[model samples]
Target: MSTPGRGLHGRVLDTLGPAITAGEYPAGSVLRTDELAQRFEVSRSVMREAVRVLESMHLVESRRRVGVTVLAECEWNVYDPQVIRWRLAGSERPRQLRSLTVLRSAVEPVAAGLAARLATPEQCAELTECALGMVANSRGHRLEEYLFHDVAFHRVVLTASGNEMFARLGGVVAEVLAGRTHHDVMFEDPDPAAVTLHVQVAEAVRARDAERAERLTREITEGALQELDILAP
Candidate 1:
């Protein structure tokens, strides 16, 4: 719902967030509100809101005399949406992808397994619809379709997981996928085998086979990572 340029505060935050993340300010470097407002062509009030957002993200700390200073990486709230966006926009390094994939590997399969045990009939139907949508859109280079189904598929898995923590992972998943989408990294042909694996996971969930669902989910995620490596190379 948040459109680019609509909110001055968000735009300012987006601009400054990346600068800090990319080390333009660096750790302990002071950020001047007036300088940033001038740089981004925004008013001080908008700039202040952006600074507040950054503070919440732990990217910058505001002090009375020193202005705002960038924090160390360990202090950052990586899970914050703005922080994730900044990271994605700051660089395109394989190490970032690898780190995200590792996180996914740890979380998604367990989510899938839990969803298998907990999904309601309606959720199962929605999951099937999402999978079928993927198959339908796989024919041409329908990137949005792929992304839609891909996001939906994962959302269902998270919902089925019956854990609020797992559901909260949706933001991270969306952020990573948005980056991949911007890079035109979704499968051009919609890998049938991958789609089939998704279906298998869906079926396992429908059947309440938690173990199979988890195993299939892991396989699907790992396969995608392998393909990403090949493509990025």
Candidate 2:
């Protein structure tokens, strides 16, 4: 998050954000603005602005005359999507995946229940369509196609919940889904049981069966957690 700016600041933030998260600049390491400016062929002002963005993420601390210092892993705002992306891109991926799965488990089941209670007929129909698309893509061994529908299904659940805070988390849900696929954590051939459960959940939401919606959603997230466990080294 580079202060919503343009050009050099974005470039510097892009280059350095992941690098720091990936431990190229490990905890407590100092980043000299002059050195970074020279290395990136940018002006000092631009480099300082970039550092300010990193500081906002709590990845680093800039002090007058003390240079910008990389903070400990615990100090970062891990929920920030940029931070999560950087961690996913690094060796810390397994831990990040587990953390995100825990979050998904905690939120999505409740969202599904609320969707059942609150979603309009049109929203419900779209959710069902997404679920059906997932089943079709899974049967065809189309992993990427399956992922698109899968992401849509979850996004619909959140949005249809009629809760602004929960709806706002759709981006986070999308990131986790895409991240799993990108990291090859997702099965190449989608799980048949998982596909069935998705359809069941969609139907439950359509029928306004809150209990079934919640239960089925929990089952889906549990399956995901199990996969993460199996993949964990």
lDDT of each: 0.81, 0.87
Task: Give candidate 1's whole-model lDDT.
Answer: 0.81
Clashing pairs in 1: 115-160
What are the TM-scores, per candidate, against the unseen true structure?
A: 0.86, 0.90
User: Residues 1-233, candidate 1, lDDT per residue (tens digit)?
Assistant: 23464488977766666788877777898879999889889899989988988898888899998898899988999777656666766663455556677788789999999999999999999999998888888778887878788888998899779999999888777665665766646656767888899888889999999999999999988876775673343
TM-score between candidate 1 and the true structure: 0.86
Model 2 lDDT-worst window of ten: 1-10
Off by over 4 Å in 1: 5-7, 37-46, 92-94, 181-187, 230-233
